[model samples]
Target: MRLLFLAVLRPHTGNAVTAQRVRAHLEAAGHVCVLKDAFDFESPSEIANLILAENFEAALALHLYRGGRLLQGHRIPFGVIFGGTDVNEDANQRDKNTVMGRVLEEARFAVAFTESMKEMAHAQWPHAKGKIYVQSQGIATTPNAAFNWNTFLQRSEINQSADNLHIFLLICGLRQVKDPLYLVDAFSEWHQEEPNVYLVIVGPEVDPVFTREVKAKVKRSPGVRLIGEMPQEDLHAVVKNCFVVVNSSVSEGMSAAILEAMDLEVPVLARNIPGNAAVVKHEVTGLLFSNPQVLVLSAKRQNDRIAYSCLGA
Candidate 1:
């Protein structure tokens, strides 16, 4: 079978990763999978045309509203995998919700990473509830033996000494929905109190305007650094070295970063949104913060505990 896999293919984002991973599995099973960016095509007709042109037997999309929307009236069958923005953000919008409803109505199957997301979709469009399946993204992290911690620190351009720094790595593309700036002021204040702490925002610049604002803000803010994207192997190495991994997104379907951190045995400090709370068991698998102040205090206490245990050992 030949399948058309559509997703928001921004270089380093989770959506792209998930689509590619799914495509690889299908291809490995002897299916011919063609991957395309949903954003590249303007309308459902455009997507339909491409599907016909490519002679795809089926279609799979990463986001309901972003990708599934284009599959609305197509003759070819398509499946939608829930995207964080689609479930948590776009579902609330009147226009997007209507389009998403139509998309879900026609979709042969839909996937939700968490039960909470499936429930949310069920509530929004009860008719399609049975078709939605819960499947967690299979996670695999590259362990780069050659990655240098000192080199990574130098590239990140931080003034703090790596030995003493309690680094919190927040991996996400620079965009408003990510809420990357949510903890900037609070983290800075905490850093002033505990000089060894730093919050590093690392990922590709997906939103140019937001990226510029973040860069400018970081210049004036202490205890925060905006590092450009790194390769996945190097990123995994960086994640292993961090004191904790952080996710400050206002909404998420599921965060690959948080899962990666947990897989690497690094504690997570995540926003207490439904998408985040679903995966991170507060005080169990990781910590969840409702606000910046809570995050700062929790992170500091966790850091101190780690330090104390190390000294005792």
Candidate 2:
């Protein structure tokens, strides 16, 4: 069947990764799945026209309000996936909540990244509770075997040698919700005591204003560097080489970067949030820090407690 897959395709963001991964799976199973960035359309009618023009059999979307909103009243039997903001952020707003409720009502089904997420959506739209399914995001990574770690560091314009470098890579877009600067000051202080350690925040410049703030802060904060967005394959290679992968986001539906790190056997240091907690089980899977202070302290303690090593690193 020809399927329409709608999602916010922000370059190098989790939404784009998830949408592409799901689309690839559908295509592998012999279905023709076409991905469309939901932001391109202004209204449901625009997508409705596309649905008819392309003759898509069924539709699927990543965010209820962003993607599912376009599928409403289209009679295309689309499924809605609750992206983080729609649950953690948008559910608190009256106007967005009402529209999302309507979207859930018409959606053939809905997907939640974690059981907690499913419960959140269930609480918001009780009538659609039965239709919401809990499915953890699948992960795939292609780390280049011959990837040059030193060259990559130089490209980021950092002048450090690659020996004994305990790189803590925090992956997030430069946005308020992502909180990329959460560990900057703490990590910088820690780096002063331990020169071998460094914190690198890398992702797309999602918001211009927030990007400027992140750049300004990173410049003054010693041992913290902000790298531009990278291709998925290169980023995965960097993750494999890094000592730990960090998630300092204020909210998340589910983090593809975290799951990919676990897959690569890299240790994770994530913020203490329900979304991060669902996967990161403290020291067992990775370390979880409650605040900025604990961010550095936890890393210091967990340095010797790493259970897994990156393959071929």
Shift of residue 1 alpha carbon in model 2, Å: 1.5
In the range 105-154, model 2's lDDT, one tens digit per residue, is: 89889999999999888889899978999989988889988789989878
1-313: candidate 1 lDDT, tens digit per residue: 9999989998898899998899999999999999999889898889878877889888999999888888888788889999878878888899999999999889999999999999999998888978999998889998698989878778777654645778888999999999899999998888788777888999999999988999999999898888888889989999999887889998888899998987887778889999999998777677778999987776556665742332232
TM-score of each: 0.94, 0.94
- Where does candidate 2 clash, by residue pair? none
TM-score of 2: 0.94
Runs with alpha carbons beyond 4 Å of true place in candidate 1 = 159-163, 306-313
- Relative to the true structure, candidate 1 has a C-alpha RMSD (angstroms) of 2.6
Candidate 2's C-alpha runs over 4 A off are 157-163, 306-313
Clashes of 2: 0
Model 1 global lDDT (CA atoms, 0 to 1): 0.86
Backbone clash total for model 1 is: 1
Give the lDDT of residue 264 in candidate 1: 84
